[model samples]
Target: MYGKKYLFFISFCILIIVASGCTIGESPAEKMYEHLEQTVSLESGFAEVQEPLIEAEQKEQELFNEMLGLSMKEIDKIKKLADEAIGLADSRGELITKEKESIDSAYEEFKSVNGLVDEIDEDTLKKKANELVETMEKRYKSYDDLHNVYMEALNMDRELYEMMKKEDLAIEDLKSRTEKLNKKYEEVLKSQDAFNNLTDQYNEKKKAFYKEAGFSTTDKKEAS
Candidate 1:
């Protein structure tokens, strides 16, 4: 009878151990780790959303470059390319704006968390998270710069159409618009460089945190 009782006791103890182990699996550290994963995911998604805009911008650039190769007499071709470029910009502009706003909201939500996971209780870790957020915030400036470039293109398109409608187009005006557009593109490039640097830093810091916290930093999209 005592042997049977001992056996039952051993089984009961094993069950309790397993139960506690499962409970312990969901720790503050794990919660924080999950939150960080969410942040990284959102950032990566934003980058993907930007790809279309980047492609469209490149197309617009090619059109602009082609304009430089042609003579002022190729006004019809210039007008057509400008119209196509404008169409591309118009189609993507709203989507980019919407995606940026969505990502901004996600970051805002993350910032609102009283404390993200137990690991963030550490001053250094919290500071790193904050810095990452700041960099993410700074990325908006690139969008602003890009908008300026877009606006310039739109204005140039309007002005060019006006000039093309005339019997005798002013070569000087077309040349001036092209020069101004190129200058604006240069500004956009600079902003893009800054944005890219920040993105690299954001990814590095995110990976470091995930490493320290024992989370899988691999992106799900990439894994697939």
Candidate 2:
């Protein structure tokens, strides 16, 4: 009877060890998913901040159009509009700078997941996670490109306004500067489009990764 009791005690100890192993905190995959979700949440304000930037740009464009219709003889009017335009450009620049900072923060947060990716046990999941990281990095790079081009366009715009304030501004100089500014804007548009496309692609890839990894898709934020 004592031998049988000893055997039962050994089995009970083995069962406790197995259960403790199972209950020891979140799995590696779960930890990585939670980290990724936190990184995504950091970008939640991105779209919200963009609205004010758009409004500021629109105001600047209206001021530019109004200034274009004024004659050189209206020097005071031209200077006033030019000052207003310069101020608007400065404000727009501030908004863009803030937006860039937000993206930079998100990028840094996303990059922290590299160690978590390494901890993932499943080969396929690890590969998918790495791919998600690559796409997100590309998306951030694309935004950086767009931000540079847009800031260049804003600077050109400020230069054009400063030229307008000059009483002796040459018609040819104005025309050339305006043309160059338009071209710069065209480049900005192209960069914006590229950034947008990469963002969409990254979102899709992230959604797919979440689904494949068996993460909950019910959270609308994660669904994005």
Candidate 3:
């Protein structure tokens, strides 16, 4: 009976040690090894070691799912915003080209009228040239103003694109963190399982040792 109690105590203690060592990102078996190395005692060394590793593994998975889901959603939204920006830039380019063509036409007409220098009065020709130049100046100024407006539109689009870039970077960081967590969990889980196997081996050895020593197996077995 006494031997059985001792075996039961040892089994319970081992379970506790393993559970304690196990943490998030760690394997159950790995944690058990750590517990044994740190606190070598019947009461402390064999306590639960698998607890933390198990919890960490679950949390890592949850974080990965959440971050990936949110990032994908945001990527779709940013793509739409980029499309709108490209459209705005294209519209501005068209407007600028039209303004340039109008200016060119007016300048050509003014040159043709001035070329009739011998057929027309000097004063009349001069007046017409001045008017043409003035009209061109007004049109040119209007083009400049419109160009500025278009640029402002482009700037707004750029701001949104930059925001999207920043968001993507954040999502990338989340991915990195999750990956590291996965590695930790792999190691910890491996250790946890190993520790459990070791404990089983120890139990078998203990029983065999008692039997070989001519200890009363029935007495210890009955106690446990």
TM-score of each: 0.62, 0.83, 0.30
- For residues 109-194, write the lDDT of model 3, one tens digit per residue: 43443333333334543444344334434433543444444344334434433443454456455445434434443443444344
User: Which segments of candidate 1 are over 4 A away from where they belong?
Assistant: 1-30, 43-55, 58-82, 113-119, 140-166, 216-224
Each candidate structure's count of clashing pairs: 0, 0, 42
TM-score of model 3 vs. true structure: 0.30
- Over the full model, what C-alpha lDDT does candidate 3 score relative to the true structure? 0.37
Predicted candidate 1 versus true structure: per-residue lDDT over 155-210, tens digit per residue: 55456435544546566766675566556556655655665565555556555554
Better of 1 and 3 by lDDT: 1
Ranking by lDDT: 2, 1, 3
